[model samples]
Target: DNIWGAVALHNFIEMLRSFFQPVNVHVTIADGNITLKNDALLEILKA
Candidate 1:
């Protein structure tokens, strides 16, 4: 059940990523590194 739960969440994240445009989200770039807000990274981390 635990494994299934993780899988389900992973799949949901993947679906969301497919539907959502990353480019639409704002990001900051400095020192040759792209920085995104915590919420943005959290969203990607979900996958």
Candidate 2:
């Protein structure tokens, strides 16, 4: 175990968010807008 584990995880999450967010994408939840991660799945559902 290392002290950088949390920092590493935080970096990974930020990378994942950047990778997933190619489009100007959002989902309309009852509470508020949420980012939709899966582009292919969204396209399939839209069809």
Candidate 3:
């Protein structure tokens, strides 16, 4: 049961990581390009 619980927790963490990966990418991109902030905001809004 403990092993299964660990596996479940790992899966949950992986899911969260995948979920936020795109947001992190967008943030990095926006930080790199001040001029693209408007475009990035629009893309985020559309998403």
For each candidate, what is the lDDT?
A: 0.53, 0.50, 0.51
Instruction: Spell out the clash pairs found in candidate 2.
Output: none
Tell me the spans in candidate 3 whose CA falls farther than 4 Å from its real position. Answer: 22-47
| lDDT tens readout by residue for model 2, 19-39 | 996555443333133233665
**What is the clash count of model 3?**
0
Worst 10 residues of 2 by lDDT: 27-36
Ranked by lDDT, top first: 1, 3, 2
Q: Rank the candidates by TM-score, best first.
A: 1, 3, 2
Candidate 2 scores a C-alpha RMSD against the true structure in Å of 13.8
Q: How close is candidate 1 to the true structure, as a TM-score?
A: 0.43
**lDDT, model 2, position 42:** 45
Model 1 accuracy (lDDT, Cα): 0.53
lDDT of each residue in 1-47, candidate 3, tens digit only: 24564477568667877987654332222344334425545465346
* TM-score, model 2 to reference: 0.38
Error of 2 at 35 (Å): 30
Candidate 2 has an lDDT of 0.50
Of 1 and 2, the candidate ahead on lDDT is 1
TM-score of 3: 0.42
TM-score for all models, in order of appearance: 0.43, 0.38, 0.42
Against the true structure, whose lDDT is highest? Answer: 1
Candidate with better TM-score, 2 vs 3: 3
